[model samples]
Target chain A: MRAANERVRVAFQGERGAFSEEAAIKLLGEEIELVPRPTFEALFTSIDEGASDYILAPIENSLAGSVHRTYDLLLERTLHIIAETIIPIAHHLIGCPQASFDDVRVVESHPVALAQCERFFAAHPHIKRVVAEDTAGSVRRVIERGDPAYAAIAGERAARVYGGRILREHLEDHHENYTRFVLLSSEPRVVADGDKLSLVVRLKHRPGALYYALEPFARRAINLLKIESRPVAGQPWQYRFYLDLQAKMGDPELDAALAQLRERADEVRFLGCYRSAQRTEKERF
Target chain B: MRAANERVRVAFQGERGAFSEEAAIKLLGEEIELVPRPTFEALFTSIDEGASDYILAPIENSLAGSVHRTYDLLLERTLHIIAETIIPIAHHLIGCPQASFDDVRVVESHPVALAQCERFFAAHPHIKRVVAEDTAGSVRRVIERGDPAYAAIAGERAARVYGGRILREHLEDHHENYTRFVLLSSEPRVVADGDKLSLVVRLKHRPGALYYALEPFARRAINLLKIESRPVAGQPWQYRFYLDLQAKMGDPELDAALAQLRERADEVRFLGCYRSAQRTEKERF
Candidate 1:
């Protein structure tokens, strides 16, 4: 751990005012320094470059499934998942101070952001959607152009950062939409207790291989929160299964189950044990 | 079924020469009529509008996980999945006939397409990448403008349809990129023999719910291909599990497995039973 006087340097992918940045502040509080990277590759390499003390990367979205790049990178890079957090993804319609919702003819954002606001676009058929590389960057462009006809759909913090007016609020199609992010560091921190566990395992290619692998947890009444099997690169038709279980590392039953899993499966890897973001009180928008 | 001479009308969510259209033709053969819908909502509602006989929608990608919109829409709509197909996703950089690769300074396509060719972008630092609404539409625009400096990354079929020249081939970072699409019709087709099975189940909220649910298949030595649990909308925390298994509809063991599954789970719905595209030979790129 660093000194109390020195603030934590957190790195996230995107422009200054991104949803990832908002999540980092909400989880780490207002005293941390934010370092923004332009791409996923850059964000993952920031820790190695000594640009930041920790990296916050999105693992999955409520509607969208897993973020494949983050999952693959977590395995490839030598980093530890210290903690995870979730935040509501709310996109607001931002524009120049002179512009109102009615004056907006074109809205710009990342394609995924544009896709999420389909209902808003459907309601306003005359407005056109243009795609940008980043959501916050689009707001900056609109503010720089000072065009009443141009607007952007992005997080609320973007409007504050760019000094743009909020033309509309909550343009996202789903209110329950949330993205889960994980904090990564080079060294693993000692945890006296953690409620969640994540692991990756490769099983023998057979019919009952997975069933037997899961039997250890089932027999002990452990809850398997999620299971995802990704194709192993260079090995066609083979998969590496990722499982999220509701058990801590220090538990005796958990240790016994892992011991049984190691004997049953071809290979097993323990990623981390952390508290579930679900256990925390959700922030009301 | 209609007469064999008349063409089958299939609707897909994209422009005329999209990868969806290519997959539909590759699966249904060239005699079918292609109906291009502008959005996923439009594509799903095409049958209600009496615009098409069937809809071909993408379910998942080898790189990306399941298409969430398609999975959610599949549950909401009354359509039945009759057939499924997998096709290689080969992105090619297309420019005007007069332009050469050296003259290109800008690239445009769907955001996902641009992202898949990350290595290409990394190599050509001078080429600026822009995001368009659709991949095929980008190629059409590039051909219409006839600018040497502007090019679009899309499938080879898009270049042929738009009369553009392929500036570079195989721009994807991974060579094994493939997309799986499912054919949905209002009426279910009768299949005398099929090897693959897809079903959805709502499990009882318990610790060992999923493990016990898969016990029947394990006991019968049936292969469980994939399992995905999606959160039940509005129900919060609860999930509806979707499973893909390697068993046919007429098998005695499969029937017994289904009987046991129904007894163990709250609800079970069979999505489809058809031949998997994996059994077919992959096209050499």
Candidate 2:
């Protein structure tokens, strides 16, 4: 077993000051060694490649819905969720030190960030929207170029990390936007107080099949927190459901419900059992 | 009702030779007037703004999963789906007439198209991938630039429209790639022989709410083709379920099931009942 006092290396997909990196720091702490991978595939295989011990990946966003890439990649790999965290996504207009808000002619950020600030762009129709590979990386590039005409939409951490000036705050259209991330490990984390259970199930292509699978859970009063259907790759229209349930692991009723669900569905995968974080700015690090 | 022989004007979100344009022509034929909108929001409002008679928007892709923007925007509007079409997605490397495969140093295309050709980019590590706004538009720009080093990945139609040369064929990772688009109108067209039904339902926040909603269709042996849950806006963690079923409109059993469903669920929105297209390429334009 690894020592509790040892600093852990966490791998995330992005540059040094990316939103994922900020999330990794918030979940694991600033002392943890952050290993930044360029892509999702690399982040998932980091532990196997002996680069990092664990990974933190975004699973869902309140406004944009689910991150399908993360869900698909997580299922393709043999990883287990150990913990979960929620971070408020606040987009800020960051520019070079000499740039003012009116001096910006081009705005750069990840596609996801740009999409969230649609109203902002609609108002500033003259500003050309440029797509960058990473949010934090965009801030770094514009600052390095020392261009007053270039601005980036990203988190506050990105501005601070890259020493970029904040031209405008709360540039995001909605204030309720938040992203949910999950910490995944190679082994099943023995979560002592885990109350949220995540699983994926493949149902038979027959009428009433899904109903029968949910019977045991509903019958036990177990709250189904979330349910999303994703197409089964190589099968075209056929799909499997991903579920998040509110029940503690090893509970007698939960165990019984799982036993019944296993018999009804063709395949069932236990992803993880972990604590769900409440959305509160006070809870943030 | 308008005459069936009249040439309808159709709007889609992309350039003239985009995959969406290809899909629209496949569904409505070449005689229809094609109106290209710059964004999904504009595409949805084209009818209300009196810019076009109908809009053809992509709903899902086999390899990439659902288009969440289309889903979210569709729910926000009061449009009815009148027809559906599935088009084969084949990515080809297109360059200027003077460019050769060996001369291409940069590949430009929409993020979606670029994502589908991951294997191609992996095989050619020296080629840089740049994200462009549209697939066909990228081809036009690269041809205008007449740069031998610049290439765009798009459908075959783009090559002919912009006078670009096909540098490589079938760059997509999967041969089975297909995208399904829905034709929406301001008023519901009388679709005879419609067999597929699409609807969105909101269930009470309880353990058995969703299971009961599915019971009505299941007991009658109606096939639930798909079910996807998306979070309800303004309410965090709460969701509404979108469903597609294999049942004809006006069928006695379907009507009965829907009535029962309405009584069991909090809210139900009938999106459309239309003829689902077969995936055979022979049925394409």
Candidate 3:
């Protein structure tokens, strides 16, 4: 920890009132300074540019699955994951403060947000859906336009920040939608309570290569939380598997498993060791 | 074999000259009647709706990975996969026949097509990018507009059918970009040359559920082509894994492994048994 007056600066992609900002605040608290970058490229380079002390990036969503750009950027940068947080994705129809739900004729948002509220769009077929660059930025634009016929789909925080009104709440088709975000820093830090480990492993392109690599962990009965295969950037059809396992930092068993993995696989990279976020039990579909 | 006069009607999603249409013709021959649907839902329902005899759907892309919507629809619909095809994705700058490359100031296509030609767009920053519903449809519209300043990015087939000129060739960032499509019919057909098997399995939430599921195949040195985990509907964090393996329909070893897999997994679903596409070997990065 730094001195009392020194606040950590966290960089995120999108406008000021984006979901990344909410996740960063949830993980790092309100005292941290928010460094909002316009694009993903700018967000990843914020630390190297000395504009931020930490970077908060959205890694995956329950509905959309993994964010491939974040995975690619993680490999490109030398940042280490320090912690993670999950936030429920609640899409609302927001408009200028003077606007009402009845006045809305056109809805605007990121294409994804517009796609997610298919049921609402279907019910109101007359309402035109316009694609915008950013979710929060759509809210900003809607408020700035001050047109009652125009509204945007975004988070509640965006409406508050942009001085917009929530014309309708919970417009998302799925109630269980959630986004998982990871906090990263240039320098690695030790977390005594860390109980999760993430790894990116590349195996030789041969039969049973992945099977042999997972043997060490299987033998130890290590719980695998998630696994994803992503294509290697320069190699077509070849992939690197990303695995999340329940193992704390400094665990001797995990260390032994890593040692065995390194010997069996072509390459193994530790992405992070951090505490797992508490999973919320929601109504099953 | 089709009758002398009775042509097989193949349904695909998009305009007349979409990549799906080209793939359909490449796989089923040019003598077949083409049925074009505006949306994926309509494409999948074309057989049941009595508009077409067969449906062609894109299952995976080497660059974009699996198309999740197609996978979900495959599971939802009772259609059977009878055959498969692969097509190279080559985006071209298409315009009115009289328009030259330098005359274009605006480019339009499906957002994904636009994204794949990032290098070309970056080099020509003066041109504005517009998102359209379909790549082939964009070419149709651009040709209809007959504006020298407007162009669209699409496969060569789109330009051919739409009477558009190819102003620039191979705008795609990667030469290895390809999409794999599966042929679907209401009734299953026996494939004697089938050498590939696809499965969707659900395992109990346990420490080594997946490890045990893969044991039967791993022990036999069977090659696994692809595996993807998708969120189980209604179950927030639970997942169902889809696997593609290299195996024939009636191979004894594969039969034995699948038997063991069924016994070990909570649920196992066989999506299809068909011949694998010819693999292309490129220089290793």
Candidate 4:
């Protein structure tokens, strides 16, 4: 309905200042439109509803591991991953503009966010934790309520967007927290210089089935970036493995390896082939 | 310290009638003493605190995927997984004895349990959803309040323990929902018939390092039950892998494979060698 030169509408879960929104802005320029959805279900179906051009979804976190619901949704939908981006997660305690760190007596955020800042809570034994649906939304509510005793844990961007103040910074227990996000599009994206390939393969139930499937890539010295085994729904014990491999697009050896792999694997679906985000420099501290 | 014949105390996360309690009873039998801890951290440290002789924790769920926190805690401690058990997860809508299905206006449970009953919630849009810290705790509170408008979602055991009535049965969206838990002990468990081995390995950051590491096992036709790559702390883009392999304890080929694998891997820690849970029959519906 719109020209290709028009701004792309990127859909993400949570409020405007959520991590997914920041990732979309980093990958696509600031000119893109941010479409915020209340839930992952709505975010995944935004393209079909003509509300978005692309969906940026968090696939995994360094500490939290894989986002299972997102992976299951990817399998349910026809969307394809075209690119990916990784961002550092730094949780900050935000409050009203007039609020100070010493005034905070209650904190609220998503359960996972609250759990990550256990050490901070341990230090402040009197502070109570309450759960909220969205991290950024909590910041907005805390500021709107204008209670100096209440604060929320979220990113620094959330404080700026919602006119809140940063009462304290970096409340997470681990400094290595980072989340990986994938950009999904309805139409297939074929990058000529793509070097990373993600595939989901289901093998027949037999001894060494996975080992045999990897032989083709292993013999060729293809680097295996990651391998995750997810249980196949309705079938106990059996699993489907998701592999991330390092190989340039259109490489003859990669083609040969895939052909050889097809014989051993019962089903192999190419989730994507795109440039990896590993080449991107880390965020400056 | 008590003798071996004394009742073994098992530490698990959550209150009584929790899934972990059921798992402990199934693996160690009814003679064991149940020690409930409020959090995973306390449960993992129970042995050092002299509160329990063994720890039982959920490692994976069929629909939800692996519990990353449990894996991380395993790496932090020196505990060894001695055995595993799988249990079916069937959520039931529970209410006070005087409450009926038609009188319920709200439901409360763990977020995971609430998420699993999407179909039931969608059918009853008027019923508000609330999040609770524990599944059985929610049932206990709802029944104690004796509110006909409030209900909790939990297992059948929770209803029996809390004296709550089951308003609805099998509220989970999928019939295949199940959870796998492992029995952990401070001392190594030697099983003469052990057929499964788990190892945490760190390999050099090279293209063929992982491929070569798997060569020894693959050549011996050893089955890889699972493979999970976790990001190494403080090292971005680097990973430490946890592998589950199928092989009898002290098998000549398994020994040869490990000996060869050591040369390729930078570091290898044997988590445990125990019998596989797949040999156990599935729970009858």
Among all candidates shown, the one with the greatest TM-score: 2
Candidate 3 residue lDDT tens string, B1-285: 456689889999999999999999888899999999987778888998889999999987777677777887888798888888888888999999999999999999987788788789889989998877689999999999999999999999999998999999999988878788999988877788887788999998888888888889989888888788877765655778888888887789999999999998999988788877754223211
On lDDT, who's better, 3 or 4? 4
- Candidates 1 onward: DockQ, in order: 0.49, 0.66, 0.48, 0.56
Candidate 1 collision pairs: none
Stretches off by above 4 angstroms in model 2 are: A1-6, A279-285, B1-6, B279-285
Ranking by lDDT: 2, 4, 1, 3
Stretches > 4 Å off in candidate 4: A3-6, A282-285, B3-6, B283-285
Off by over 4 Å in 1: A1-4, A235-237, A282-285, B1-5, B235-238, B282-285
Docking class of 1: acceptable
lDDT of each: 0.87, 0.89, 0.86, 0.88
Chain B TM-score (model 2 vs. true structure)? 0.95
Which scores higher on TM-score, 3 or 4?
4
Write the number of the candidate with greater DockQ, choosing between 2 and 3. Answer: 2
lDDT of 4 by residue, A1-285 (tens): 799898889999999799888889989989999999977888899999999999999998777677877887887898888999998899999999999999999999988889889899989989998877779989988988999999999998899899999988999989988888999999889977788999999998877777788889988999888877787888866788888899987889999999999998999998989888876645343
RMSD of each: 2.4, 2.4, 3.3, 2.1
- On DockQ, the candidate that comes out on top is 2
| Rank list by DockQ | 2, 4, 1, 3
Tens-digit lDDT string for candidate 2 (A118-167): 89999999999998878998999999999899999989999998899999
lDDT tens string, model 1, A1-285?
568899899999889898999999988999999999988889999999989999999987776566777887888787888799888889999999889889999999987789888899999999999988788989999999999999999999999999999999999987878888999998886555688888889999889888899999999999988777776754444678888899988789999999999999999988888878877835343
lDDT, candidate 4, at A173: 88
Report how far residue B211 has shifted in candidate 3, in Å.
0.9
